[model samples]
Target: MTTPVLYLFGSAAPPVADVAGVITDAQHRGFDVCLGLTPTAARWLAPQLTELERLTGHPVRSEYKMPGTPDVWPKADVIALAPATFNTVNSWALGLTHDFVVGVVAEGIGKRIPTVTMPCVNAAYVQHRQFERSVSELRSMGVRVLYGEDGFQPNQPGQGHPSEYPWHLVLEAAVEMHQG
Candidate 1:
């Protein structure tokens, strides 16, 4: 039997520093991991692309392919958006497909694919009225929004530590969804 495919989406949050670790963990958990990064996140992680590709045996993607081009990655059995930033959450909720990451996620929801998102926003961003509404919108669409006490709690404004971003929780959620 083939291992399940996980399309891991990453946004430009500090926790993205540990994305390599997440990829490694996913592989250990029996997933074929494919990485998709938002533009800023791609730039932030550029130096590690070769290593990341080596680990996953797939190229890291951060932009949409041109029309008529064949997709390189396999279709995902599940999608996990970790270190999902406030901007990405809002953009996705608003159905903005301006970037590759959001575009794929939006399409995934439309396809009713199992999707999970774990935001890495601080307290100040969470306070924004749009943040809560965005989370609600995603949940309504059947996407697992991993926020709150059971998932990710907002850190105090300007007090977030990237190392504490619960990357494992997001991976676990995705794995559970895939297994079930």
Candidate 2:
């Protein structure tokens, strides 16, 4: 059986050493994923490591590709942006789709796909008035924005670790999204 296509928009561009486990976890739960990342993420993570073509049977593009060129964009059934950094989160909230990650999300919205975001910004940014408004705006647009236990987590130590895992929340949200 073919798994439904899911696209992950992530900002953990710093080659999170342990991300394979999480990707495998999502795959096992019934998804063939296509990964989109910011340039920073590319530096931190391996493009091949994300398992785009291997899993989805399509090219995973993090940048704008030539239109006439033949590349199959995985037909995303669900779109989730996890570990969403403050920069990306604010852009997404404001409907600014310049970056590839947000661009794909904007495309998802245009397609009426089930979408979710799990933000992991710094505590200060998460507490900012503008940030809160953006979250509200995203929610109003039917986008599920999962907050950390209390707010955002900037990968700080000794601050209650797993409680701030936005990726896990995205995983959970993806299950329901695919099911629905």
TM-score for all predictions? 0.98, 0.82
Residues 5-50, candidate 1, lDDT per residue (tens digit)? 9999999999998999999999998999999999999999999999
Candidate 1 ranges beyond 4 A from true positions: none
RMSD of 1: 0.8
In order, candidate lDDTs are 0.93, 0.70
Over 18-49, each residue of candidate 2 has an lDDT whose tens digit, in order, gives 44556777888888877777767666766564
In model 2, the Cα lDDT at residue 66 comes to 74
Q: Model 2 Cα displacement at 172 (Å)?
A: 1.6
Instruction: Estimate the TM-score for candidate 1.
Output: 0.98
